[model samples]
Target: MSEPAEDPQELAALRNEIDEVEREVVRTVDLGPRAVVIAAAVFVLIVGLVLPWMGGANGLEVLLGQHEAVGKASWVPRLFATTSIGFGVLGSALAIITRRWALTWVCALGGWFASVDGVLAIWSRQSSAGPGASAPGIGLIIAEIATVVIASLWFRTAWSRS
Candidate 1:
């Protein structure tokens, strides 16, 4: 004769148990030393936000469209600011804290995207400069460099797993 069907409650319990085990496995995975470097770079990026970016306006001012140059600047700088804060600082922090492989991949990809945005933002600032126009601020440059470093480190960490 054929075997009786399994109990529904038992099957649900088994599924929950399996999920817990999977989560434990993911939690135990190490991201190696690069995670520390990523954290430091994120910190640098945060510092960059408070420094002057355009027309003596800080990164936060630029992002918020409160800077005088914001009216003249293209969308590149604004976009860079969003991604840098969103992916570089927040996303990276979450991934580092959780140490989840999927989150790492997400941060890695987002970091690369933000890095490209950083380059374009710098280029836009330079290209748009005119007589008596203020040059790109030190903070912007520092933030861009930090973004690149963070992206590269995240890529290395994510790729190392595979």
Candidate 2:
């Protein structure tokens, strides 16, 4: 004859344990990307403001190219870049201050925008057969990607313990 089945309480306890484990796994898998994206967004914000005003070898100028001819950079492009930078800085600050995930998401979106900007800059160089043809600023793209991956993994691992 077969042995008696596990008690209902024991079975339920085992199920709960399994559920807990699954939750931890899910949390671990998600944290790294979130953190990376947020950090990247903050970086973008800083570049956005300081680059336009200061105009130097910083990430902004490097990524978007200098506007040696202010006339060459029209109002629309300038407006957009300025807006993005301001938003990035504000959103990131809010997130950091409040420790709110929603704010973090805003920061991530800005990061996404920054990443896109980087990609577009690279593309423009390729199309124009400009200096970007040599794959300049490629390092920034790699760094951003690396940031995303590392942050995601770190977030996942840290949250898993909770």
Best by lDDT: 1
lDDT of 2 at 45: 45
For candidate 1, the per-residue lDDT at 39 reads: 86
lDDT of each residue in 1-162, candidate 1, tens digit only: 999999999999999999999878865448778778888999999999889887888889888988666775547888999999988999998998888877777887998899899889888888885653566788989999998888888777777763
TM value for model 1: 0.81
The list of candidate 2 runs beyond 4 A from truth reads 1-90, 130-135, 138-162
Using TM-score as the measure, which candidate wins? 1
Clashing residue pairs in candidate 2 (N, C-alpha, C atoms within 3 angstroms) = 28-156, 31-155, 31-156, 32-151, 32-152, 32-153, 33-152
- TM-score quality measure for candidate 2: 0.39
Task: List the candidates' TM-scores in order.
Answer: 0.81, 0.39
Q: Candidate 1 — worst ten consecutive residues by lDDT sum? A: 127-136
